[model samples]
Target: MSVHELAVTESVIAAISMQLPDSQVAVVHLEIGRLSGVMPDAVRFCFELAGEGTCVEGARLDITEPEGTGSCASCGTSFPARDALAVCPCGSADVTISGGAELTIKAVEVTDDV
Candidate 1:
């Protein structure tokens, strides 16, 4: 998983670098929810490895995991969800997961070489 995360981070660096040509990445902010099935620490560690020899090298990785919430359509009850297969306490499979499934790059800070 860390290996995959490294690859993903590398790709993100490439994409973001294109947007800020001749600049150095200072920080990378991300939102990794509980249901996203990713470990923030692992991702952060891998990010450092993946960023080697790239503009993202030495950049800080800020990760945030938002709380998970879901609703059971069968009972119209909303509850906390740690994963997608959150079974409602009322014994219902008609569950709708909300939040906690995000794996997004919120922001990227870069410094122009100038």
Candidate 2:
């Protein structure tokens, strides 16, 4: 896995640990967009390593990848944006990517403290 993913995972664990210091994390819900530049697989691979000895250890890593969306400025058309440079149906290159490119932690599930 990339070091970037490891850093991201560490940050995630740090945030969760800070939020629910007394609880046992059961799951980590993540939303990784296609344009986000963060790989879901890399995060998954690094989760366990990052969460070692932390509350998030052994926690389930839930990731969701949202497809990128773009809007055409010339024709006012909205379409899927698989890449940064997207073309519009009207043969216009003036497209604005609206959605995707998000790496969010939607929710965190925790188990009851013993």
Candidate 3:
């Protein structure tokens, strides 16, 4: 999973480079979820390896941990969850995940050419 994510990130950076031919990316903001099955440490490690000799090489990576959210159908209540165990305070097993399973690039910082 980590290898795949690094490959995907590299692809995204390449796409961005095409749009900003004169500028270089300096940083990338990533949103990582606990349930996304991605470890932050592993991603950071793999990013360095994957970015070798690329335009995104040596770019700073900023990661955000998004908490999981779930909604209860019994009492129409929504609350934050920490993990896959989504038991509502109202004791409702009928819950749907609303967030925290996403891995995405939120923003990219680019350096203007001289």
Candidate 4:
């Protein structure tokens, strides 16, 4: 999983660099949810290996863990759910998950000139 994530992130950075040839990326903000099945520590460890010799070698990685959100089937109320427990306030076990499975690059900080 960690190796896969590293490959994906490296590819994304490469694509961005190609599109913006004049820019030097400084930071990459990543939105990592608890339900995303990705370990932040694993990703961070592999990121350095993946970025070796690349333009993002020394770039900073900012990870954000978004709270899980779910909708209760009993009351139809949507609210933040526990990250791991994922229990609804209404005590309904038939809740449908709406969010917290996201793994995306929120933003990239870049310098026009280095």
lDDT of each: 0.82, 0.90, 0.78, 0.77
Q: Count the backbone clashes (under 3 Å) in each candidate.
A: 0, 1, 0, 0
Question: Which regions of candidate 3 deviate over 4 angstroms?
Answer: 1-22
The ten-residue window of minimal lDDT in model 4 covers 1-10
Superpose all Cα atoms of candidate 3 onto the true structure and report the RMSD in Å to 1 decimal.
Answer: 2.4
Best by TM-score: 2
Model 2 stretches astray by more than 4 angstroms: none
Candidate 1 local lDDT, residue 53: 79
lDDT of 2 by residue, 51-98 (tens): 989999989999999999999988888999998788887889999988
lDDT of 3 by residue, 16-47 (tens): 66776566678878888877777777787777
Among the numbered candidates, top lDDT falls to 2
TM-score of each candidate structure, all chains considered together = 0.85, 0.93, 0.81, 0.77
Q: Residue 42 lDDT in model 2?
A: 92
Can you list the residue pairs that collide in candidate 3?
Answer: none
Report the candidate with higher TM-score, 2 versus 3. 2
Minimal lDDT window, size 10, model 3? 1-10
Model with the higher TM-score, candidate 1 or 4: 1
Q: Tell me the spans in candidate 4 whose CA falls farther than 4 Å from its real position.
A: 83-91
- lDDT of model 4 at residue 81? 71
Off-target runs (Cα >4 Å) in candidate 1 are: 112-114
